[model samples]
Target: MTAPIPRDIPDLPAIPGIPVLLPSHVPATAVVPPVRRPLVATYRLLVALIAAAAVSLELALGSPLRTLSHFAIQSNILLAVVLTLSARRAWTARRPLPSALTGATLLYVIVTGLTYHALLANEASPYMLPGVLTGEAAGPTGWHVITTQVLHTATPIAALLDWLLLTAPGQLHLRPAATWMLYPLTYLAFTLVRGELLVPGTPARYLYPFLDVARHGYRSILANALLIGLTSYALAILLVALDHARPNPLRHRLHHRAKTGFRLQPPVG
Candidate 1:
């Protein structure tokens, strides 16, 4: 004979035409709260304001806030912000932090487009490096030079890596090394092609100002590249970590209060 069923275990309950087992006990689990919508909206608005300031800066300075291309990019970022906010209101009813912040990063890139332009602009200066390494100076040399410089330089690769970092499939894993290496790899290709290191008339390395800190007056280009590489990787990782950071003390207190209020609200009995 089968052993008697335990007292704690409920037997199958038979209805006229159906059989079902009912559990006697169910344990609840702690649920992780979703990132709140208002938090994302708050951040999105801040990014929007920053973008607006960039526009204002461009107008005041009577120059495109980076590249003229950046103006269109800024417009796209604004569009993304509006689209994201609208979609959240209509569908999720809460803005997602990741999506909103990705848009913010795009906005940031647009704002800094001019800075990159300034660095890469072509001019007839004795200081700027020539041909393969420097690309073109950012002065009045027109789009032909600017476009040529961009094609020759590592900016495209760097931008592609930035795009990848922003839109990686799942949870945002910060790959700082990958991001940092793109520029160096591209520049290295250009440098090798020009034989800038071995050639007698190696121009100044200021074509990549960021790389100059390690250049040591054109003596140790690779060493400088490595240094810049390390610094770039470090900063990228730090920024990504900081981006994913949860609430700090003050924010934690506010969040705690909010969660407490949510929990204390009466549920329909």
Candidate 2:
């Protein structure tokens, strides 16, 4: 007395195969894009956590306003924000941020690391911020050293790694390099103008020694700034070249799957 099965549905084999009642219209490739590599997910998660920890220490130790006043700390916070967002996109299978924006973030962190190591880390320098990048104190200084490593070393390296290993290749272009240089230049200009605005009591906020007009005359600072800008442009060129090299993680994963005889099931739809 039961009604007949629908004509649109394919009858299941009597050998007890997958249930015909369930829909299997989706393609296996749609469910598992190769760009969602586990290695990348792990890297982004660690980078987000490390960058977050580095910036959090700044807020923990003192006034949040004062902590963010430092360019290095601020740059670290920016990287943290981007990494968090990028990670979320990556994990959720959404398109990643545009290469230019991602490249700028990477360039900023690299500059922060390079400036600290080249100009301030090894020896006594007027630009060195107290309780940062030092290892002398027993309890508190340990945190500074750890935080410094996270901000300067870990973030920069992890960012570069994500670009090289996780993200797809050939997205960056030559013109973006010039555009990337602008962010640092604008920051330098803001630092100088703010220095002029500050009252003559608190420490002059030059951000970096090379930007300090009084210590190093405008001429010398100009040369330094120009050099840094040129370096940034060159680094951008290198990044573009790397992208052109086609270090695509997704392709690699797909190739591996193919070689391993792992084919996606054809969709029914």
Candidate 3:
């Protein structure tokens, strides 16, 4: 005779169509409430506005096509869009963007700033377009100066601040760092193709000096590109490392309260 099945235990195999459920004693996982960060949202929104304004001013004041072709302009535009969305998410207590997207955006903007300061800033006139288009043969001034500083200096610094001060840490991964190189690589290809299509004497045919195939030749241009690519990869890796190492500034207060068993009390009227 077959052993009798326990009455308390439903015969799950026999009841194939019936759903099995957990015991009442088992607790369901708690859902965490989303945190609303108004200050973070406001700051991000301001930075986004600044970036957008700078890009707009550049387009209006200079040759629109040439200005749009610049890596700095492109990166800043990405930053503006990303930050605007991030600001809305923060304000609404929505889940933040994926770490990979935020990290890549940060990396691109940093690269823009670093490349400008390290390579282009030292040029007598770093404007990609000729004086006829930019009207800055003597060097950028007035609104040009403001836009330049905002795009290359202020925007990157603000982004770094947002990441460091507002966002949680350890979200970035090493694998994503490698993937972040895709945009830079694509930009390199675009620069080469665009340069080839333009006539040799066309002003700003090659937007950046390092990628100027006409002057540097394909061999030298490739070498320069390789060096920059490797450097950018290294920077990305470093960013990932730093991200993992950084503490969660946004959670510090909560952690401190939990550790110390502290609670907030309402103020007496």
Best candidate, lDDT: 3
lDDT of 2 by residue, 207-238 (tens): 56667776777898888889878887888788
In the range 1-269, model 1's lDDT, one tens digit per residue, is 89997779778766786656788453221222233344434444444444444344434443342322232234434444553553354233332344334433433343234334433333533234332222333342433344333332223333324334322223234653254346445644554444444444344323344444334444465665566456555655554554456223223323353343232211110
Q: Which pairs in model 2 have colliding backbones?
A: none
Residues 150-265, model 3: lDDT tens digits: 88889999999888888877878998788998999899999899988988898778877778788779999899889889999999898889988987785544333333322232
lDDT winner between 1 and 3, please give it: 3
Measured with C-alpha atoms, the lDDT of residue 5 in candidate 2 is: 86
For each candidate, the alpha-carbon lDDT, in order, equals 0.39, 0.69, 0.78
RMSD per candidate (Å) reads: 12.2, 10.4, 7.5
Q: Is candidate 1 or candidate 3 better by TM-score?
A: 3
Off by over 4 Å in 2: 1-39, 124-140, 256-269
Each prediction's TM-score versus the true structure: 0.35, 0.73, 0.80
lDDT of 3 at 219: 99
Candidate 2 global TM-score:
0.73
